[model samples]
Target chain A: MMPVGNLVGMVVRNTVRSPRHFALSAFGIVIGIASFVFFLGLSMGVRNVILGKIFPLEVVEVVAPRASFMGKDITKKLDDGTVEMIRARPEVKEATPRMKVAFPAAGFGMFEGQEIKFEVGGFCDGVDPKVLADDPKLAALFKDWEAAGADDPAKTVACVPPVVDDKGVAGKNPCPDPEFYYCDVQDNRCHRRVPVIVSPTLLELYNGQVASTHGLPVIGDLEQFVVERGGLARMRFTIALGETMVAGSAMATSDKKRRVEGMLIGITPKAMPIGMTVPIEYTRRWNQEFAGDEAASTYSSIVVTLNDKDRLAVFSAWLQEQDLRLEDQLGERFATAIFIVTTLFVLISFTIVTISSINIAHNFFMQVSERRREIGVLRAVGATRTDVKLIILGEAALIGVIGGLLGVGIAFAGAALVDWASATYLPRFPFKPPTYFDFKGWIIAGGLGFSTVFCVVGGYLPARKAAKLPPAQALAAQ
Target chain B: MSEAVIKLRDVKKSYGSGAARTPVLRGVSFEVARGELIALVGQSGSGKSTLLNIIGGLDTADAGDVEVLGHDIRKIGEKELAGLRNSSIGFVFQAFNLLDHLTCLGNVTLPASFTPGAKDVEARGLEALRRVGLVELAQRHPSELSGGQKQRVAIARALFGAPKLLLCDEPTGSLDSETGREVIEFFRELNEKDQMTLVIVTHERRVSSVARRIIAIRDGQLVDGEELALGAPGDAGGAGAGGPA
Candidate 1:
């Protein structure tokens, strides 16, 4: 057996001397590894957008089973009790009750200096403030204003209204705490606006579809627009409680109609898909005012956040026993589609690497044949058969390392080019990612490891043959 | 008499099997004393090289007792045989067998690579090159050197381990006569001054003339008198003495 240093020296010298012989072989490895890296990166990037942004898998929405015909209830009601029960499970990180506005409502708001009116029926829901706890900025702004004395007429103070000059331009309002309180012109009273959060999907829809069609300026970053920018960009809106566009849809009479101020806080995936989400306390108070105590307490749905997604099956089974079902069937289907597509791409890459390894084997066999006399000479100089084998394998390993690094680099460059093309040439669309490839560290390392193992495997048979060569016969060869 | 460095009794070897079997060394017996410089002279296909390979532990005898440097060649395992070949026997081949990719010094130190914990390999290689009077060409690759320089480098490599015996199989076969004469004189110097047991196998009378005694082989068997008078330089009378038995 040769010393490791001596073996490495010989292997390096031989490989460096005859690089052309291994170039073609290394090219095959590079192509195989590059394809593996590129395809895997693309898959991961698309999956991140789909599963992470559009339909997050971390939280599952649980809803009561639909009522049977003949006005009979079919399952247990989704309420605070159900939320508590769900939260008690070990897999449940959190279970927050969500309530839709039980009464008809209409919202009129000044967005970027333009007055806009929209119906809030079936679109608005309320969630616990704890949902935004992970984001301190959002959590700080989104809270129950009524619980903080906004609903008490005696607690309210006189507002310092904005001064209007002769040209009808209003100056900044003199309210001291403008972030949470606003000066209502009708009542001349400072009131805290109901803080609300909207889903990222809703923002994507508004920017990608609605804003473009309506010629309205799209909100770029919701947090920056609502929190960072001051004055009219603060997104103050008024909701006419108990009064909707459809006159007969109001559950309460005209005398019960009341207007409440609302403020846009930030965007979150946990928000309701199509509308603004406010604190559960606001919805409870309004539900009790316009409908009944039962409507106030009963939730529309419960969003269950799971600590371990691997135990989701068990959680889902428990939900079934509680007469509820997960509302993420579409997300599950999308995840399955992504998995199958990624697996197919990986299998295709594996096949390419396997074929390339065979090519490596063929090249090594030819090299061994050409260097028979050299092997014989080494054997004559006291090199064991194992030494000959190791020298050959070591050369193959060097080729693998070089080819693997080049392959990874090429894949990264290819991804950057694709991302540049997407950003430069492609039109904006809903959920379109900024980049289409995610080159994670493990993926690059795996590509290199895969190349080296395959190359070594390819060299095994040829190395064995070289090691088994008869020294006498090899020396006597012409 | 000096102790026998190499002892072989009734050594037999053959190639192939069945009707295709051809015996290369049949019942050949010989002893080479320590520090003795001898030659085995034979024509092509006369098995002189085969006998030398067995003596150097590069090949095994079909049925016989063979010993080199006090170790039984037939009884040792492949690893032990490789160790014996690496440390106890030095082989100088006709083709020089210098790796073209390596420098002259690199080729000289090739055998030392197999010795675990062996230090100062380059220095020892340089010393061996100095002995061969090619120290200045240590950095030159084998392809850059002339045929005679390459042969001297191969000899330096053969002497790297300071082995107990040196085996030469037509060592001067590839050189001009003058270069061949120089290599032969170097072999004589190694034997006389260094007391290295040397065995030179050759068909050329000039190469054999430098040896103290000659053993001629014919048709896989030694001649009646294994030891012959040392042939004088340029002697051509017994050039074809062992042809076809």
Candidate 2:
């Protein structure tokens, strides 16, 4: 057999002489390889989008029910004690009672003449700024938010009321803290006035309803609004204190159009008991509301903070032992669904790529058949059958390479287009699928290489037949 | 007398089998010694080409002991047979069989390329073309050459590897009388100077007279072998001289 290099050189010389035919065969391989590359990148991009939105790696969200009550509404109250239980777990690095709220809660916010019916679905659950500092992930998110200036000074903690006590010392909550978002009648201190945080989305919607004469609101300043209490209307507005909301506006219940409003107050970590289940007020309220056995009492879920994040499952099992659910945001399910669908799409794209590669192989086989006379001459002149085969295969591989490169080029263009569109229209997560021309380009190149080489393999039998033709008969052939 | 370079003993060859079988050679025997030139004279269907093919190892005889350059033709596989043809036997076809795509030198060097250890093959091919006095035309394609020149290139290709036997199916069949004479002269010179063994299959009496011996075949059977002295010294030729090797 001639050296593989010599065979390759001959193939190159011959195929290069007939550029048009080689280009066509190579184009087929390019399509197959590109499909492979772009599809995989697309799959990864979609996966990133789903996971980025759903299972953001750094977030540690804690959850519990919103309210507590006596009588028939006793079941509605959250068992704040679960928070303390989670905090006591060894994995608990830092814990906070993220207070949530619902509409129909009494508040004294009103307008002139008619009491403003303010349905305040408190979007921003109250959180201490210290929690953001303590959790590196939250700190990073805040830094990004601050860099973007997504909110004003008022929206940031810079201007909010300092968390303090009744004696005028900072770091206190005047009203009793609900274990979750609500309080029982017996946890009487909650009856005192307290503030609620609102999300920017809620603010945007609320701004649409309010007239411009009121001026676009800033985060820290108090905004006047009205509410209804026990069928009677009242005119009131708390000190407009702005706070940032992390996620959605709120979950809508019935279309009852209930009105509730309140001030948003900040609290320090010291204001709540250390490792106490259901901040003191939440426990007191739960006791008053359910009046049930302590062990049987519980909330919907608890957010356990682990000292070592790797132990979340261990703590989760512990929570499960106490008969509680672990609640994740709605995004988790959405991400899972997206991942499944995207994977299927990738598989489908790969199938198309495989079929296209086969087509390329067929085309190369035809190419080899067309060149039988030339091949015969080469073989006659001492070119071994193996040499001819290599030459043919080498041509196939070259075509694959060209085709693969073309596909990767296409993917790069597509990636640029997508990124441009995302930057223009949907800049929420700043997500653009990874560009194909980078690390992922090798994948495409490999695909091209494999397919082209595979195409050569496809034409192997034909090349052999061409090579084995008796030179005498070959010369005599038409 | 020189040792026979090619020998066939009662070679019987037929194509197909059973009802479809047709014999191309019927009990033919011949021996070609070194430095001899012989003509196989016959009509188109008289098996001259088949006889040439068998000698060249391009075809097999059903029953025969055929040898070329000390290798049993029947015992070798197709690949080995091809190797035998490459290294030991050279063919000059009626059509000139010069590859149209190659230059004259390329055509000449083609057979050498298949030869093992054919180093400096380009130089060797050039030298062969020079020997044929067509070295100046080396770069030109076969189409650019006249019929005589094309035949000369074919002859140069045959001479490239210095084969033990040169088989010419019809060296002058496609040429004019003058060109045919020139080709015959070239063959006569090659045989006398190089001591080359030559086998010419032809229907032309003019082509046959140039050979020291002639074998006639009619309808796939050997008809006669005769010596045509033509004033050559110490010559006793034909199938009588081509007795058992």
Candidate 3:
């Protein structure tokens, strides 16, 4: 066999003998690899948006089992007693009970006078407003959700890291009042924002699927178009309480309705199929006057938050053992779809690459046949069979690496083109991705590396055939 | 005292299998002492090339024991045989099978690439090219060289590492008469001046006349001086002078 120092030169020299054939052989592999990288980048970008922007991993919803009763399915109330029992576990960092507010559709808007009706009658859920202050872990987890950089202007798209005081504690309660955004303390008169948690997915759904159909304005970049607007579009809310309302009545009079002006202070992800959530204390206070029988401080379900996901299994098992079920609210079906799509994309890419490999092998076989005399001469000049094999396989590997790098470059340029076209001409495209592709270093390397290996693997048999050609017969022929 | 560079005893070789099996070398026995210039003369398909290949360690003998440069043929591995070929035997072919892409220097240094940790390959290759009087054509690719120049490069390649035995398979078959004569004279001079042992396989009288001993092969068997009527046609004065080198 040839020495290590000369192997690369020999391979390159042989490959350069017929550049057109080398290019033709590598073209198929390049296409396969480029599409592979493009699809990988798309999937990774989608994952960032779905998981990073929408799902809150630190929170999980727990509900009591309906099997406790024999009648039609009823939500077994999660009273204060149940909340304490579940919170007793060491893994439970914070447990906040939730309640549903019963308000007229006209009452759900920003401020008292400006009536902005929701197409689906926006959800007004309730929870303890002091949950963030009581649980430092939950506050720290959602520090960025409720507050922005203190120095940032109210208009720009900027989100800074959570500031830490000198004592090393993260600054979470940026607002002067923990339970309110804007208020007046004198005369026991205080007007506060209805602190609500609405998912970014809801805004996306409204803009993409629901809003334009219903003749509503499409919301793009909620922080810019909505939150920074500081008007009916964002920082306001209104609630009304009927003084003489009856339960489940067809015509209940609301002549003594109490309208309250509110502001939007905090935003949380409703990761599940739930809607807007507010403080439960506010809901119970309103429900007490509206319906005496429905004013009890019991909840059908509660959300328990943990500091880390490693402790979730133990906590979840403990809950299930106690007839409580858990829901990640991050979507099981969404995760499965991502997994299936990713797998199919990879399999298809490999199938194309494998076909290309076969093409490479068959192409080199032709070259080997053409160079039989050359092989014989090399054998006569002290090159062993192994050396010939190494030379051929080395050429194939070089072609593979070249094709892989070309594929990655093609993918990047292709992604840039897509992003530009979408932004320029298809701005109204329902699911306008923030970016066309996400380029990860390791993934690119892996794609290139795998392609190179497969090329070598594909070259194995043909290289062996080249090596095993009998030198004397080959020399005799020419 | 002169030592035997190549020794073969009862060496046999055949091609194909069963009904198509054709014998090439049948019980061949011979020895060429170190520094002896010999010509293996035979017609086409006379198995002369096969015998030379076996001696060069490029092919294996099927039936008998053979030794080249003190390495037993049947005892060692293929890599060891390759190493033996790399170090002790150099082959020069008729077609001048220099890779078209490599320069003359690159072609000459080809053998050094196979030996592990070979140093000064360029210097040695230039020296060999200089010996062949083609030192000025060292940087020229084979395609850029003339027929005589190509043959000289091939010869320089064979002589690059200075092996113990140089084997030429009709080295001048593709060259014109003048170039062929030049290559033959080059071989004679190397044999006489450098003490380089040589085995030239040819049917040309010009090639065989310069050899010290002309061995004839017919249908896989070595014939005597009287039975060389068909193979050695122009061996009038050169044939019967068979004695010690």
Q: What is the interface RMSD of each candidate, in Å?
A: 1.0, 3.5, 1.5
Relative to the true structure, candidate 1 reaches a TM of 0.92
A228-281, model 3: which lDDT tens digit per residue?
A: 465332555545555212346432464545554344443445322446655566
Who is ahead in TM-score, 1 or 3? 1
Please tell me the TM-score of chain A for candidate 1.
0.91
Ranking by DockQ: 1, 3, 2
Residue-level lDDT of model 2, residues B81-111, one tens digit each, is 6676676677887778787767899889876
Over the stretch A49-127, how does candidate 2's per-residue lDDT look in tens digits?
5444324422355543344556444333345565666677777776655443222222333444333333222322333
Candidate order, lDDT descending: 1, 3, 2
Q: Which lDDT values do the candidates have, in the order given?
A: 0.85, 0.58, 0.73
Cα shift from native, residue B22, model 2 (Å) = 2.2
Candidate 1 per-residue C-alpha lDDT over B168-217 given as tens digits, one digit per residue, 9 for 90 to 100: 99999999999999999999899879999999999998877777668888
In model 3, the runs with Cα more than 4 Å from the true position are A51-60, A65-74, A79-97, A102-114, A117-122, A127-187, A191-194, A205-234, A241-260, A266-274, A279-297, A304-322, A326-330, A429-431, B225-245
Q: What TM-score fits each model?
A: 0.92, 0.63, 0.81
- Please give the distance, in angstroms, between residue B32's alpha carbon in candidate 2 and its true position after superposition: 1.7
Better candidate number, 1 or 3, judged by lDDT: 1
Model 1 accuracy (lDDT, Cα): 0.85
Instruction: Evaluate candidate 2 and give its CAPRI docking class based on DockQ.
Output: incorrect
Candidate 1 regions exceeding 4 Å error are A148-154, A158-179, A182-189, A226-229, A246-255, B229-245
